[model samples]
Target: REQADLQRVFPDLYMNSLSNVLTQGMNRKKKHEVEALAAVVSWIARSVGANTVVDVGAGQGYLAQVLSFEYQLSVIAIDACSHHGRITNARAERIKKHYAAKMHKSRSEDRNLNMPKTVTCRVLSTDTFKTLSDSLLQKDDLQKANLTGKGVGEHSLEGLPDGNVPSCCVDSKPSLLLAGLHACGDLSVTMLRTFLECKDVKAVVSIGCCYNLLSEEVENADSQCGFPMSKGIKSAGLSLGKSSRDLACQSAERWRCLGKDAGLHNFELHAFRAAFQMVLFRYYPEILITSPAIGRQGKALRRQHHQRILESTLHHEESAHSSPSLSQKNCKKKGSCPTMNSAEAGTAKNKGTFEIPLSDTGNSTPKSCGAADFASSILEMDALFRGVSFNQSTKCEATKSVDKYSLFEKFSRSGLCRLGLHHLQDINFAGLWKETEPFAELIGPYWSLRAALGPVLETILLLDRLLFLQEQGNSLEAVMIPIFDPTLSPRNVALIAKKI
Candidate 1:
């Protein structure tokens, strides 16, 4: 479809406004990115001849509204974030009213029974996948909604038919499954795997985000099983390796080069900020402070606010540094700090010679480690953070061998963890999950960050698995489509299988 056609179909007026806002500062040519995305969505819809489309991360339900209203296709928009989901639901209600009014005015009768039912928008977090699915499978409201072209009222999926699968529209299992725009960490992966596991889901179109959150495990079911394999075949399914960050780094490098070419010193800063903004929005919900009068804040005030944040963080670091324990002294004595040397101390005669006494209550002097091993661990962490490229085999080994307690010990002693903050152990993952739980509840949804990350990592690792599926004499009825947009970093790569 053409740009005008796509615009006519899009339901979210706010998203249209956002497109305009995003384009305001960009160059004329670059301003077409949103338009291009809309066009791509329209093209995919037409290509699949989809009668019903469900967007997994349907923020604001812009695309869902448009598809339902414009193409006359039933749409189900789902999101883990309750705030966004509520906004989308409200927008859909507004559009439904508008459409009903327009039909009455134009004297056009609502003719078709299957002509797009009221868009079913739900606030569903990705974290509670199994729970949500199980609840959905038992819900009667959804079953009635599916059979009749009516919407499910305020109800859980407790009595819905086939609610075991996330998508309610897949009863007869439509020929097409669509997830247009999705977000970081795990959401994107969940969509791809959902498509893979659900038999009625014939085609999938998805875009993914958040590479680092993906699981390192290779044997996940979602990643291994693309099509319906026999019980024996399923068990024998091969494992896909770890998700690679090479593509993400490549994108970063390109941005860096672009910045250098333009003589911009802080190109990487801007790039990093843009990348971090997505993470902060998804993981740290508090960072999004939406004030109605925020636009009125002056440049000076904004700068002051930024400075205050930086200063506050620095102050916290300083406070943490002032208190030193016995372990810290031993860490220092081990010569972990490259700058501290015997020769430098000798030259600076007035320098204080601080020593910890060998006592219990006053803190006993801790034993020191061999200088070599301490230095080696430090170097290893440094190397990991340096973004050095490593092959999948080597990378997996390195990650598995890394000791969490030692890293925590190092962090506790030197406070370097507070400074660099690069190493991400299993405990860090656990803590992140714990932290995200309350936020998920605040948003009125249950989305497991780990489950989402696992599937996406599975999808990336299973790029080869798709190739294997094709190689194993599975007919070319389904084509693997890796959705990669140069403008936006590749979030997801989906395999679309069509029944020829």
Candidate 2:
């Protein structure tokens, strides 16, 4: 993917759409996207002279409801998830009641609002999608639609020529214009293919997301892949490696807008995750290869980590009183033992380090004693293991500062135990984190750069799709437009095509 394509695409290729999301049960960000996309779908429907709008991957049917009730376009909302269809229908009923109440408030003579028909179907292929699209337009579906005033199948689409009528559609005229908001991977490409293949589907408005799920032709040519759709790309034999494809979905703009402290906090999380991976690699190599996913231990354990750190720091007195043998009173007051008071305990707590002064006595605390020294009162293992130095601290400046390695180790055990690896023995998590901790600081800058590079990958993909549509013929008018604020919706660009 060329970086220049980004400049080329942004300045000229995408049409900017503006609107507010008014649908219920949606967050502010989702509302912005839905409203903008619904507006575009309405415009395309009017331009293409299509009476019906088929919203594929309708999710909970936010866009579908808007296009139907707000824009007054006949709609058929389809999703692979059966539960989504049920939710959409339920929500649609609520919306319909709201509309009815509004008309009553105005005291206007109003007819019933037509609800978008819900269809739960996994659209796998062009033929499969075509069958679903065609069947819903037949006389049987039309009779069903008559129950509501001029619903999806019963829409008047008289002007479409014989070429636009499918073999299955005898007398029914469902001039459908397809619309998809964040259609995942192959489903988006499948809609485009279906639009070209099915006669009744005269136009398409699609916005795709989840680039990571896209299959590559290079991986297996037999599989109907989504990437490199254009002859331009296929001719070049280009492939977006799976890792880079995953990067394409990262929203640099969203990350860039994050507050300074928030951004650094997120970066620290990435560090913890990286070190945890190192733990798996060192201790459970076979399990790491077998079940690669540890499932976001950094995120799940963060609250617990912070609580433990706070408690260990603030509750030093509680731990200090527990073991009388390791108590400061047990040591020669003027000996190598460091004194602890409210101030010293507070300092140690904030520093998140457990420190014990090294002694000249042959029975001196080992260099590693500092690793978990705050808990020396609790463990009291020093008396039992005389020669075996259980708490050896590595002599490193970075390790001397704040012992995040211990915090990371704490996180690692929780993660490992979550995966039922508690029975494994002799796993040195502190040592594992120490080896990789130096690279942790680089994560913030590296992530920023990766986020910046994401849009380039996304641009190349959209360009390939646009070029593919153009490669079809001049009879098709196609475009990739910015339909939502990128800050609100990272996958904001929509791929739209209409028969000219």
Top-lDDT structure, candidate number: 2
**Which residue pairs show backbone clashes in model 2?**
313-349, 367-393, 368-391, 368-392, 368-393, 369-391
- Candidate 2 lDDT for residue 403: 47
* The 10-residue segment with the lowest total lDDT in model 1: 356-365
TM-score of each: 0.43, 0.70
lDDT of 2 by residue, 1-500 (tens): 11123334434232233223235578778777776677667777887788788899989988888887787778888887777877887788888788888779888636667788877667877767776676567544644322222332223222323245445556666578989999998899999988888887889998899999987886443455798888878878788888889999998777867655346656766787788877788777888888566565434334333344345434545645686555545233332122223232222232354432222111222223233432332222121111111122311122123345544544455455556565245666657776887898899899888888899999988898889889999889898778677778888888889987
For model 1, the stretches where C-alpha displacement exceeds 4 angstroms are 1-49, 97-176, 218-257, 261-264, 267-462, 468-485, 488-495
- In terms of lDDT, the poorest run of 10 residues in model 2 is 381-390
lDDT of each: 0.39, 0.65
Q: What lDDT does model 2 reach? A: 0.65
